[model samples]
Target chain A: MNTLIFRTIAPFLAALMLVFSVFVLLRGHNEPGGGFIGGLIAASAFAIQGLAQGVSAVRRALKMDPLGIAAIGLLLSALAGFLPFLGAMPFMTGLWIDLNLVADTVPVSSVMLFDIGVYLVVAGTVTAIALALEEKETD
Target chain B: MASTAAVSPALLEQAMSIAPVPPEHWLIVAPVLVPLAGGAALIALRHRPGAGRALVGRLSILLLALTLAANIGLFLMVVEKGALTMVMGRWLPPFGIAFTADRLGAAFSLSAAAIALLAAIFTRGEAGTGAPAYGPEPFHLLLLAGVSGAFLTGDIFNLYVWFEVLLIASFGLLALGPDRAELDGALKYGFLNLAGTTLFLVAVGLVYGVTGTLNMADLAMRLPAMEGVPAVTLAALFLFAFSMKAAAFPVQFWLPAAYHTPRASTAALFAALLTKVGVYAMLRVLVMLMPAPLEELSLLIAAIAAATMLFGGLGVLAERDLRRLPGFVLISGIGTMLAGIALHSPGGATGAIFYGLQSMALMLALYLALFEAARLAGTPDLMKGGGLYARHPLFSGLVLALFFAAAGLPPFSGFWPKALIVKAALDIGAWWLAGAVLLSGFFLTVGLARAYMLAFWHPQRPPAPVGRGPQTGQAALSARPQKLALTTILPLAVAALAVIGFGLFPERLLQLSGDAASGLADPAAYVGSVFPGAKP
Candidate 1:
């Protein structure tokens, strides 16, 4: 049955979401992937968890509150945007400090940090909403 | 470590001479904080009996008061300064996150906050006794955050986030209500809005690709500077997204279906506040950001606006459901605002802002009145409710006042803004638009009259033992004004007084909206503040 396939494939899909979400979030600064897409992927993973299991089971497993995570993510993302200002750059202007790494120079900017903030937001918001609706239906 | 982006310390210091970022702009943070923290606190105290309601009520009131104070303070400050723009981080204008509070955004956000404040009071305890009331507290907070985000966000992509935030909150509110009507309406409303939001996201993505920047004021400057298909495509996307919100033309069926589904007071807030926020966004972007494309697409937009106004009014007239009538009326009013923009004059645009406020106030009052009438009649059917003056003189009288105010009779808050818009149309040689406004006004009059007749003038059918029905037409008026507590009455009173106050002194808000309009027209001040080194 389709439900069986969905169940069997869900864990793999969730694992893929975790990997892709992080990959997208990391590459957002100069590449195609970013916070929003990454967040969607994570939320999809939670949704699959709900679909594969049940709302109560998934809520117990997650433990953390998703909406709270979203709020914090927004705050963190906003904080990331404010980082460039200490140096008198504009809001959200990227700041890169070259670090000596294993082979070559590594650059980390505030925008990358901001992207992570967004990824957290997306994951938190979507998952929270999905879980709430699922729980409501069960009741 | 506190980085320049922590708060616009310098700007805040210069403006207020206080701790930077003025509490108002920072007040934007409260919605994000309160409910989330409150939700946690609630979860922690779930074992406690009779505790959550008091806590939630206190928190909701406290935060709403703070939001009110922020808006009032921000308005006073902006009035003193002529214009206000704050970039989130020290990031420059074109690239950084910017939040601007021109008079229009400030005023409307203030209006919406006022509506939510009263609505919160009316619905606060209605969620039913004990922990985990009706809709979740976190849900309400997100709704507040979403509205604040829309009002403050300066970029197109950011607007999408706000819309998503609003949608999610709305869905939660709708679904949590849990009734057949609410569920059916919620499913339709949710799916439609979700689809619209997805389209909006795609549009925002396309806009970023085309402009390489997402800040709205930045887009306003750069978009006009760009040319051809990409610009047109972005314009199309923006139109599609905003139109979905405005509920104009063919896309508006869901509003009528859903606006009446919630509890009457809840419906009042939705009818008054939510969709206008969309109209507000359209007013901001269409006029400021993509004016050139606006010109190219003016006729198309104008045609749609005309269709929205006329057709929506027809639907209102045809609808027998009193609750459903206001939904259509609100859409038609949006059509008028759109028409003003299409006329493309400062006067027209200014009228649009004022009329937008009028429509919201009128719709809220009307819904409040209609809800009472429905309760008295034991159903929402307009035909079922009649001859109530003897039974409830206070309710009947207030409903009549609300009807006139909504109908745009003179000496009420609703008339001035509309008169201004009509005057603007005449000034701009928009005879057709002017005519449509008048024609729509005529039809709206008839629609309200129908309610007046059904509820007040017509005889109520006689009750067998319980109440009356077909042809028995006698009435028992409730002796007093329906018992709206002080908090409930306060918003309605404030709104009614505004209608009267503005009717007397149209110039008070008029000058403010006009100043905001002028500030919007010149991109230099906004750009100069954000990107100090930009080519402006």
Candidate 2:
């Protein structure tokens, strides 16, 4: 599985997939692509990288522990849920803001933050599990 | 004029009843969100060098204390104003999720949070000083959050989500111990509980399919009007699934197989809260949502309760491992609670609720006491345990009080609930059930007395001198007397005192349970709280 051609292309493929994952996550508020699917895509990308470049390379690239990332994601999601409280709204009520650029208005919402948190949690947990399995195989 | 003629009076009433959200509405969700946020923050900080066991332990205790306070406030609010509801995201009920707290839910949540707080304190001593970063603390808080959510959720599907949350957290906790036994037990617990939740989901689906709604209050309004086989079948499915979760009678094998393998503190938390959630769900669904079906199935439920009590008591008598004994005792207590549900009277419901609350405190106390006693004895096996009474009179006395409470003796918390159940049974002319309740209590007394005699009364022989032949590790460990830590004793003593205090002053709990039961029997207020302005 660790052929020269695959090893050479895996990093660029993984990078492209990560970028695509972020796009998918960002568009999820009104599209079919969301945090869950985006996270899955990124996780699959990590799996591919692990398969080609090995576990250590993937681990070095990731930097933080996957579980810690999942924890931060959880905290972020919880914080997003709490944001509505500042406006005296109910828990999990979505608050929106419009970023008025010179040429266009980009709509942002607490819902998006919540989705990103979900994205990180899913990606981190799945990557952690997959990485653990891959390392176990070599041992 | 035509539009006015087309509208129903109930619809018009509901339209006009859209009152502004009250200021105290946030209290409805606080019990759930507080622990959830706390758990997430703790996990995020878990890898930091400063996040030691002591910090995690105190943080967990504080989080649970906050949850308990929230629950108390919610309970008071519910008591003062009837049921309280918080519809998520400003959406009306029947479309949005609702966190509704009636007497029963609030009381159960309060008891669960209190016991969880006590368990956290007990864990402080059990985890020992300077242990590695407390990985399980976050899961513990998360578990309580799930439990609180389950108690408070007003939507059936939401209840399933809470069950999953608690189940996942429990899986993490059950697997925390280093022993291979922990893994094995976790597998059994996980598989069986997952199956139970799947069954619950199927039941939820069927209810939604038949009734066109998932809001429990809406279902309560709609279910009774629907007739016949579908409703009864749904009730049976719910009963079977929740029975498995509650570890009652036939599906009860998994609990005893799994509960004894976890760390004692984890076991205590499971004992106090997990099955009680199942019982609470049963009370809400069977007694509140579908009374006709429950009545139709009362004979079957009563039989299950009787068998559960008998078998649980007999299992206790047959068991030798001290750690495992509480599992059986817990099952027996569940049977008593089930008996209350089976009776289906206001008195019966009162008994069930009261028994459930006391059982939570009692089980927590019992497990903590046993954990300490086993530490002093150097083994959990009853056969090798003895002389605790000679050396530690206070500890022995505490255990005795807990035992007395467990056996439903007078002047202890267990007695009142059992008495209520028996009277409810005899009032309904269910002589056999009344007899079963009494017989089970007797069996429990005998079983616990045997445990006390074997573990505390039987004198231990002096340890074999070192350097003579080969000394077994158990003997070497038993040679040195183990002192009870103050952290350990303080929580156990507090729990014991709470049990004794409840037993001595049963009036307040009795009144509360009575009100909770009456509220279940006639859920007009609960339904009104959910729908706001809808006519009952």
Candidate 3:
């Protein structure tokens, strides 16, 4: 259980994975990566932290209850689906809002919000299960 | 509605290019979305104790009421103008995820929302009666969302997803009580239903593989044109899986075993809604997509119906627990629907659909009545709780009406549907189906009457100790045996009135059910509504 090398590298590895996860989540709408995969990556980061330290450390790092995070993610994803309803469209119809930056204008769609929500949902669910198992073993 | 083009010309163009979304399409998804969103929100606020749970609980009920209103609106719309169809994300049919609200789906959704609203209210009484793991408000919301989604979805895979959603929620509800019996029941319920859904998924895969599409309308268009045997096999797979879920015949064992394990009101909701959903799926898929195969399998279907009816009768006769008796009665109700469905006549289909809705109300009323009856006698055993008719006339009266209705007696909601089903059977010259229907009704009457006599009309007997000893909050029920809370009274009244309303206006229900059946009989209208320009 006392692997200094794993503990030392865990933080750096988790941090890198989290960054990569966000990158994947953002690109999910247009390309190969999406919320599900990105969330898995982020979850693996937390899982690695749990293995290196303990579930309490992972909980401290996340700074939120995993289930609460999952619930929020679900609400956000469902909210994304609801946006189109305001536009008088069918459920989950993609609606775009244009964001104008100083340099260029960007089109942000509800689909992106949906993807991020999925990412959080996946990450939260995985982290929750992993932490629960870790805690169970300690008990 | 600002002209965003003034700010950015290109953005305006992009926004304008999106088609003017039909305002009615929002109604189509409201039933599903309201519950989904509400459930997610409830889950987020789940950690909040007393006030939080209570607030969310009321909000969830309010949302269910809203969904029911939407369902009524959707039903009227569909009744006025055939089926309503919407494609998610604007993709065309066979390629897009589609949702279609036909009369059947609308009716089932409305009934589900109604049952859920009452169940949410009933849970107020049972709130702290079980393990906190029940997650009552959020889980109930999720369950309603699943039921609505299942009824509303037009794609086959989406139906499977909805099934999983409800199944998961049911598992949580089923295991809520602290009794080890609840866990045992949950395990059986869980594994059997998991296997059923798995089989359903496999059938969906096979059907998709054969037709290269999952849309119900697309499948209808392509299925008859493709090889016949594989299609028939797929239909049979659906029959098996849905039958298991419906707790029909050989598969009916799980219902009584698992159903009685939950808290009474929860068991009422399950009895009221769950198997009927399976029945709805069977009616939708088999009758709509594979009519020819259904004709071929009519004999098998009839046999299953007969067996389900007979088994249900025997189960009711054998069941000693008052709370559990309703579970077997529910099985009998499923049998009645199956018999109606097996006849494959318009009258039969109408009867089945009508009975499905009626039984939903009646079964819930029966369970709630049982809850009241047990509250009066301080026990759940039929043999122990006596002298109820002498004491609480109103409770006994409601229980009598529901029981008679459950037994398919005349001047009740159950009679009209049974009449339609029996007439259909006779018309189709299916003597066995007709005989089975009548005989099941007879057995149901005898069995229920026996339970009634033992529970209410018999000489007074000292009540047995309840499964859990006199609990704190609900313990007040036995103390105040002479009066019932309006919270408890309201749902039962709503359910009883719905039954009587349907019974008195059988023609209206018959017309709606008839329209629903016709849609199933000739899916051309359903398909056309989904694919407006496509040549049938």
- Fraction of true inter-chain Cα contacts (below 8 Å) kept per model? 0.19, 0.55, 0.67
Residues B233-273, candidate 1: write the lDDT tens digits: 66777777778787888788889888887765667777777
Of 1 and 3, the candidate ahead on lDDT is 3
Candidate 2 lDDT over B1-536, as tens digits, reads 22344888677544332344555777888889899888877876777776766677788888889888988888888889889888776567787788899999999999888888888887876643223764578888999999999999999999999999999899989877666767888999999999999999999999988888999899888889876539889999999999999999999999999988776678999999999999999999999998999999999999999999998889888888788898999999999999999999999999999999989999999998886787688767788778889989989999999999999999999999999999999998999999999998999999999999999999974644456534133443354459887878887888899899889999999999999999888888889988856755
Number of the top candidate by lDDT? Answer: 2
Question: Across residues A44-108, which tens digit of lDDT does each residue of candidate 2 receive?
Answer: 89999999989999989888777778878887888887787777677776678879999998877
Question: Residue B81 deviation, candidate 1, in Å?
Answer: 1.5
User: Chain A TM-scores, all candidates?
Assistant: 0.87, 0.96, 0.93
Q: lDDT ranking from best to worst?
A: 2, 3, 1
| Residue B57 displacement in candidate 1 (angstroms) | 2.4
List TM-score per model, in order: 0.78, 0.94, 0.92
lDDT of candidate 3 over A1-139, digit per residue (tens):
6589998999999999999999999887778999999999999999888988888988887876787787788888889887876776666777787899999988888888888889988999898988888789877
Q: Please give the DockQ score of every candidate, comma-separated.
A: 0.16, 0.49, 0.53
User: Which of candidates 1 and 2 reaches a greater TM-score?
Assistant: 2
Q: What is the TM-score (0 to 1) of candidate 3?
A: 0.92
lDDT of 2: 0.87
Model 3 lDDT at residue A91: 69
